[model samples]
Target chain A: MKLLRIYRALLTAQLQATAQYRAQAFLYVLFSVIRPIVFLAAWVAVANARGGSVGSFDVADFAGYFIALTLVSHLCMSWFAWEFEQDVAQGNLSPRLLRPLHPIHYAAAANISYKIVTSIGLLPILLLVAVSFHARFQTTLEHLLLFIPSMILAAVLSFLFDWVQASTAFWITRSSQVSFVLGRVSFIFGGQIAPLALLPGVLGTIAYALPFGYMLAVPADILRGGVDPARGLLLVGAQALWVLLFYAALQRVWRAGVREYSAVGA
Target chain B: MNAPVFVRDLAKSYRVHEREEGLGAAMRALVKRRYRDVRAVDGITFEIGEGEVVGFLGPNGAGKTTTLKMLAGLLYPTSGEATVLGHTPWLRESRFLTQITLLMGNRSQLVWDIPAADSFRVLQQIYEIGESDYRVRLDELSDLLDLGPLLHKPVRQLSLGERMKVEFAASLVHAPRVIFLDEPTIGLDVTAQTRIRRFVADYNRRTGATILLTSHYMDDVVALCRRVLVIHHGKLLYDGGLADLATRMAPYKLVVVTLADGASPRFDEFGEVVASEEGRTTVRVPRESAAERTAAIIRAFEQQVVDLSVEDPPIEEVIDRVFSGERPLSQVRS
Candidate 1:
């Protein structure tokens, strides 16, 4: 109970801090919205070039898919790798290590707070895109119930994966480069380039096999009614499994990272 | 019961990469680098009983901060055994951590963009301090430090002195039993430094907490710490009372003489002339000969000797001699 209160306090402080930089926060939301809109535009054009349908998706389907993708990705994204590297290199981790609280809570609180605070701006943009593009989304009571759990699981899975990657800083001085590589891989496999259905058959299968699709594509697909109840359950199971695996990985990485940190000095 | 803090042969070393200047050497180093072990805290042993305030004195790179980090559980000793409150510091168990705090003057743990008061609240939650207890402690700290209206300002907006006060307060929200302070007054003005020093003394007295403070200012040591540990080149040169360290390192007495008006007398024959001004001369002489030197000066100019006084050299000078290798380390006395 006490730890939860501490986490909430940290989260609230992070939200307040983020509010101080209004202009940067605006830019953050704008740029994040712009990327998926561009991808949505390309797919819409493709469906138009094909006279209303391309690879089982119409222009409306593309619109719904892309909008949902934008929302899910924004909610689940983790920028911890860069932040972690800066914290380690600048010796900012020293004060944190001295505190009794586990430092991961600080990072988790900040990440969650940023997402929640930015979602206010994001929701309006998502609505604007939905209206302007005439996107048609289909949903049911079952999908709504599953969507909440899927979104939460996706967030945990993404954060843990990024945290594990960020822990490479303990062993390598240039962990930022490693983070960049991992981020690029996530971008490609997490359905940023295109919906998994439209991706090459083999690549789509590979995306489903890995944890990337579970982070973005699965939640978005569920929200758009592209998944049936049976598949939705399977997706939720997969997300839970990935969450466990990545959580284990994070524990291992953090232990090694702390040992390296102490050995190397602050 | 064991001491609150104890160490046995605590040491730490780092493997540093070596490379020569030039593109060729850098390129070669990338292929194969040579590494050397730099011992930051060579084998040193010490102990501190509960409620003791010990000052750690050293020049830069003398491993004062490194030893503090080890004791605070922020660093693992390369080879040694250390315990704080009967718990191994490096393990960092919650039971041990809840009873200790570490404050670095140069760094801060507060959220930078928010008000420091908000950060204090966050600390209250983190340490699980009860509402009434938190309020009482905060009120006491605020009154002690004269933190009026500074807590509401954003941390980045606060001056260095104010921010340091907030940092100090935030670290103590839990009323830690053992506190590690690393240069708690590094860059403060004279008044601010004095405020922090007085606060430290008062807090120690009130709580009976064990404090290990490291500072470059000698006054900080003289005012708060009876015992001090002096380190040089990663070695413990002395560990004893501050006054004893001074007496052992500086076995000389400073004599200031004010000659009679219009009568200048030669004082170099008696001792080393540290300074000479209009009719007033300050001389430094061996402790054993200070009396003889003063008597000889009075006899030489019975009418010219207006005033004379003998005193120990300043602590700064004694520390300077120790750092400059003027006084051999083996001469240290406990």
Candidate 2:
């Protein structure tokens, strides 16, 4: 109950901070679409050039996959690692550390509030992209039901994944550079640039082996009608397992990292 | 001093990776890097009775902040035992944190671009202060710090002093029992500094909260703390009364004499002339002979010695002497 109150207050403050920097928030949501659109345009052009189809995907199918990837990517985005890097670098963590709450609450609230504020702009822009591209988001009630759990698990898993990276700030200064590479790897393996089915053999195997695909592509794949119900259940289980694994990793890493905290600038 | 803010052999040393400049050295450093242990706060210990507003005096990088960080549970001490309000600080149990506050003058908890009142609300929630109690404390602190006008203003809109005033309000909303203040008055104007010092002293008086404060500003120390712990280069050089500090570091006093006549009898026979200007001369005389020197100067100048008084050298000079090792730790009797 107390944690809930703390989360509420922090979320309010974060929302206000986001509101204050309207341009920055707009740019943040704006940039989320840029990558998916680039991929959509490229794949759709290829499909069109090949007489309107490439293997299992038509031009409309390419549009649907990347568009769904963009929306799901928005849900899975967790930049707490970058924020943690700044907090440690600026000695901002010192004040937060003295508080009774774990510093994670601050980042968690900020993450949610950023999405809430940016989603207002992003939802419309994504709708416009979908309309412009004639995106075919083919799905059924079962897929939608399965997507609900899959995306939630994916979001929680991504946060834990980023949190593990953020925990490195406890020992390594300017850890954001390393954190950025991990984020890029997620885009590569999480079906952001290409559909999971389209990923060449070894890359596909590697993506599924790692937690990144479950963190992103699994839910989008479910939403885009690419998976059977049995496979979707299995994928959701994999996401939950990944969430639990990353969560455990974060707990140990965060504890050790905090132990190594230099309390810089204080 | 049972259950007081206790400490025993507290120390914090950091293993800092070292590397040299130049591409060759950087390349070599990639394969093999050197390391050095910096004892930011070496083994030093002191106890403070509850309600004792003790000043931590030291020059920059004198382990003051490191010790405070350790005590506040922001940094784990390399080796030591410390308890504030009967709980180990470094463990940072929620109950322990609830009872203490660490305020850094250079750092802020207030969210920028938002009214300080909003940030205060967050603090209240974070501290789990009861709604009624939070309201009462907010009113009391706001009234005490004259934060009525500033609380509604965005933190970025407020002046540094105003922001500090709000910072104090935000930090104190929970009414922490042990306050670790690191340079809380830094960058504030004199009026703001005075107000904050008075607020701190008043807060301690009202609540009997133990306060350990570190500041380069001696006025802050002199105004609020009668007992001061002087740490130098990670060592506790002096731990005693502020008055005793002056006596220990500076065994001499200054005798300021106003000469009615521009030309005066040579005062060097009395002591060293520390300063002379505008028909006034100040001499540094041994503490023991200060009274006698004043009497002798009055007699020698006769009616020419218009006015004269004997006083200790400014506290800044005494503190400077302490830090500069004029009175080494071996000599400090504290």
Candidate 3:
């Protein structure tokens, strides 16, 4: 309860600070939308070339998948990796370490505040795109309900997973290179480049095997509806497992990272 | 445990990567980097009774800040132990943290883009300050620090001195009982520095907070700290009253004599002439012989000698000599 209050206060401060950059926030949301739209347009062109259908997707299905991808991507996003690198390098982490709370609370609050403030603009833009593209999304009450826990679990899992990667800044000077490479890896294997089902051969298998797929593609796939019941259960279970794993991993990494911090200098 | 702060042989060392300045050396370092251990805080120990403000004096890279960081729980000690308010500092329990604060002049805990009050609210939550207590404490701090006019301004918009005042209020919102201040007056104008020093003295008196402060300015030390811990190269060289440090490090006493007229009385024979003028002359004499020399000079020029006063060299000079290794550690360690 105390931690929640702290988070709320921190979140409030973050909101007020971020609100000053409303134009920049809108621009950032616009830029975030461009990627999915580009993917949607290219996939639509590919489907039209093949008699208006490819595998299990047509123009409308492609639009639905990509639009859902946009919303799902926004739901679980965080930026502590880049920020953490600067904090570690510039010794800004010193002030944070002085606080009673773990520094992660600050990052988490900032992440949530930025999302909440920007989503006001984001949701409207997404709705306009969905209508313009004639996107079709079908889901049952159960599927829609399942999407909530799955997305929440993915959000927590991906946050910690990325946070663990960012914590490498404590050990190595150029730790961002790890985050940088893993970023592209997550983009490809996490189903941002293409849906896991549409990937050919081993690529699809690799996507499912890695945690990245659960982060983006799995929750998104469930939201698009029409998945085998057993697979949905399996995906949600994997998402929960990843959350626990990263939770434990984050604890260990944070301890060792703090120890490593003393070793380095500050 | 009886003291508010205690440390036993506390030491901190860091293994830093070293590389030579050459493309070839850089490539070689990539394959096999050389590491050097910096004993930033060597085996040093001291205890502060409750409410005692001790000035931590050292030159650049002298481990003052490093020791403060360790005691404040920002860095773990490489070896040894420290207990602040009876809690092991490095453990960083919330109970322990709420009772302490480490303020760095070069760093800030306040959120940059927001008004300091907003940041203070966040801190208040973190420390679990109650509503009434928070309001009362902030009111007091505003009065003490002149923060009323500045609290609503964004931290980035405040002047350096104004920001520092607000910074003081932010760090103290928890009413930390143990405060570690690293160079609290650095980069501030003399008037601002005096205000901060005065505020610290007044705050310490009222709250009985144990403060360990590091500052380059001697005026800060002279004004606020009666007791000082002088360290060099991560080792404690002297720890005692400020006057004692000057006396021990600098073993000479300066005697200034004001003469009425024609008062030249072989001042060179008594000691080195530090300064000379038509009616005044200052001489540096060995500490042991200073009194005798002053008496003899007065007797020789009884009619001419109008006034005489003996004093130790300035504290900065003493500190400089210490850092310059004029006196060996074993000889000067108090």
Give me the candidate number with maximum DockQ. 2
Each candidate structure's TM-score, on Cα atoms with residue i matched to residue i, is 0.96, 0.96, 0.97
Candidate 2 chain A: 10-residue stretch with minimal lDDT: A170-179
The Cα local distance difference test for each model comes to: 0.88, 0.87, 0.88
Worst 10 residues of 2 chain B by lDDT: B325-334
**What is the lDDT for B18 in model 3?**
95
Per-residue CA lDDT of candidate 2, range B1-334, in tens? 2656888899999998898889999999989989999999888989999789999988999999999988898888899888888888888999998889999999988888888888887888888889899889999998889988898888999999999999888888889989999999999999999999999989999889999999988899999999999888898888899988888878899999888757655789999998888778999999888888888888888878777888889999888877787866676656
Candidates by lDDT, descending order:
1, 3, 2
User: Candidate 3 vs. truth: CA RMSD?
Assistant: 1.6
Off by over 4 Å in 1: A262-266
In model 3, which residue pairs have backbone atoms overlapping below 3 Å?
none
Ranking by TM-score: 3, 1, 2
List DockQ, one per candidate, in order.
Answer: 0.65, 0.81, 0.66
True-structure lDDT of candidate 1: 0.88
Tens-digit lDDT string for candidate 3 (A106-166)? 9888888888988998999989998998987876777788899999998898789879988
- Model 3 off-target regions past 4 Å? A263-266, B261-266
State the iRMSD of every prediction, in order shown. 1.8, 1.0, 1.8
Query: Deviation in angstroms for B25 in model 1?
Result: 2.3
